[model samples]
Target: MKDQAKLASDPADWSIVETVDAVCAGHASALEVTQAVLDRIARRQPVLNCFIRIDGDRALETASGLDAARSAGRTQGPLHGAVLAHKDMYYRAGLVSTCGSEIRRDFVAQTTATVLDKLDNAGAVDVGTLNMSEFASGPTGHNLHHGNCHNPWNPDHITGGSSTGSGSAVGGRLVAGSLGSDTGGSVRLPAGICGAYGIKPTQGRVSRHGVMGLSFSLDNVGPIARTARDCARMLSVIAGPDPMDTTALPVPVDDYEADLDAGVTGLRIAVPKTYYFDDISPEISKLLDSALAVFTSLGAKIVHVDLPHHDIIGALGNAVGSSEQCTLHDFWHQTCPEKYAPLIRARMQAGFGVTAVEYLKALHLRSSIARAVSDAAFGDADVMFLPVLRFPVPTLSETDVGDGAGLHEILGSINHCTRPINYLGFPALTVPCGFSASGLPVAFQLAGPAFSERRLFRFAGAFEAANGLSDCVPDLP
Candidate 1:
């Protein structure tokens, strides 16, 4: 096989973009890529437990069809012949979609997700489903039903959750890219821990029609991949107005990869002064400084910005998320609460007393708060940068908050930089910067104004080129 290097589950193995080009140009066969991915999954899944299901036979069959189409001189779409998997939350018609809960263990979706449909039309192969937090509730990647997804960089470290499998699979190179939902940092945290790139686009930027709802207002559908270029390719195909989702923004989707090579020549970047760096460890702080120096070397100017209402913004997000989750699972909570995990059950219960007036008031403040964050960030900068996680990625044993000792404090700290941006309805991209002393990766998030993904990718691409960070795969020989 031409892509024999793909068998290692190493990040430097293959490219989603180039794979599509080669297959469509008759230079490579889709079946080969699928076989390589299946082989990697076999080797890596046992160690990381990243997948809930592996549809190897069906995936190989699909690849064979794509190969025939290419031989017939036909091209599918921009993503033609690329292989992928997604968080089990995304629906696929006629397939069992376990949303990481015992309550939905046998639930099968009747309609497919719009994002999945877009991907299929683009010629991307759906290999299987990845693991996630039980009901997408926790922050430290724990799932009582499905097994926890371990970090690929260090198997003992937690893979930041709800989108746990998405991060581990991409970082492990079992597939080129995967769709992950981000409601309060699910996508960002795993990216940081697993040493990969993840983007949570603006609220309503991607359709959530057939996606299981964790929070109708705060949920975002985005991509996790080895590089920003791969993410840009997937995001371009999945984003835009969708009739199935009324909340999808009507904004015109730009060619995300169009300006990725433009560089950050005159771009303004921000390093926050508060909340993000609060209580951060010395190692992470030093790493952030070094990451900024790389951007400075790329000709971007750094400005310091702060959000005094950041904590409030994050609290509001949590309040809304919990209340919405409780509202959706009311029947289950009332009758089958035992089916849920103890930690998430307690969190869901926290929203029971949220008065309608309180929830409404919180919703009303979102627009103003978004404007406040935007004003502070864009006043002197185009993008705001901060560490995705301030503390080191703890062992799975260190984060079992279900036992209730400091439960709130422990879970709250993991989503520090992530939840605030979701509440603001902005875009944030986490790119691996370096590894921590414990061997897990450290990352910095680049957040931009609403729907500015192109600008974010441009800056990220430039910094990635300067640092050569994503290409540093784990030595999985």
Candidate 2:
């Protein structure tokens, strides 16, 4: 096992640029890069517990085959030989597809997820499965089923979830990129806390065919990567209609990497002045101010907007999510309640109490809230900018661990800026903005209306290029 501290300090050793350059120049084989990732997993897994399972032998075999084919002048896909991992919630045939809960710990999928198949076809090798929040239920990243995933930046701090391990793995540089499911900021919140880039695509933009569903209506799968270009590359492979999922839109895939260098000139960016900024830490607020300044310098018009129904959006999102989750696990809870974590069982039980009328009312409120937010905040802008999480990452020791009032407050605060977008089914991207005073990372979020992913990427990429923040990497243990 390699020393993680040594690997963490050596930025040049971990840069994706060097890995790709080596492969292209024939100085290193993709098999070798894959092997290195596997080796790092072995070295770091004990301390990080980032992976649920490591298919090192299969990964090496596939990488070697790809290298041999490429050497023989055979063409490969865009992501040829890139080492990748995904949250364990993604169903890969014959692999255990646990949603980080005891009930489904041994559940195996007969078929692979659409996103998994797409990535494999693109020539990305799956090295392992990353950890995640149980059933994608909580936001603080504490999982009673598989232990909490610690932040790579500061091990004492929490890695925001339910995409806990996906964020930690990418932040820890254990793999090139990973996929995480975001229902209500599962992807972006962790990415923000861990200093990575994450995208929560529009609902129905990507197929949810084989993913473990928490909320069928709000669930979205997206990439978490070290850089914006890498995320775009992965999205290119995974973004398309799937015959298995009728709800998936047949939207055309655009090249997210093409206009990355193009500045955000003549772009209208909205900065909401109400709920989004309220109760945020002063340091985080300052970092957002600095980010807005960078956009202003890049010739983007920044306008202040308002969202009055933000509180309603949050409440409605919880109602919808809890109801959907209850429906998914009703049989399991009824038959084998002991298998579920206590907190999850309680949450699932709460759904049973929601009346049909209440559910309908919540749905109606969701629609109205979405319309109000769109009209007030997004009417004049290409996208709206906000924080991914309300504050810096919390220490693992400090967050609530049980289903109590403190736990609710912790979870709600973590999802404060994110739940509304999920309820509205909008697309969002989170990119690192600056570091907190304690040296933890803080992120700024950008969101737009449905199917506005390309524009979101364009604006985010432009902001990334101008700020040059992605170059900052954390020192791992």
Residues 272-291 of candidate 2 have per-residue lDDT tens digits of: 88888889888888888999
* Model 1 TM-score relative to the real fold: 0.97
Q: Cα-based RMSD of the predictions, in order?
A: 2.1, 3.4
Write the residue-wise lDDT of candidate 1 on 149-194 in tens digits. Answer: 8888888889998799998899877788999999999988887788
lDDT of each: 0.87, 0.82
Using TM-score as the measure, which candidate wins?
1
- Residue pair clashes in candidate 1: none
In angstroms, the error of model 2 at 90 is 0.7
- Supply candidate 2's per-residue lDDT for 176: 76
| Local lDDT at 424 for model 2 | 91
In candidate 1 the C-alpha lDDT for residue 367 amounts to 95
TM-score between model 2 and native: 0.94
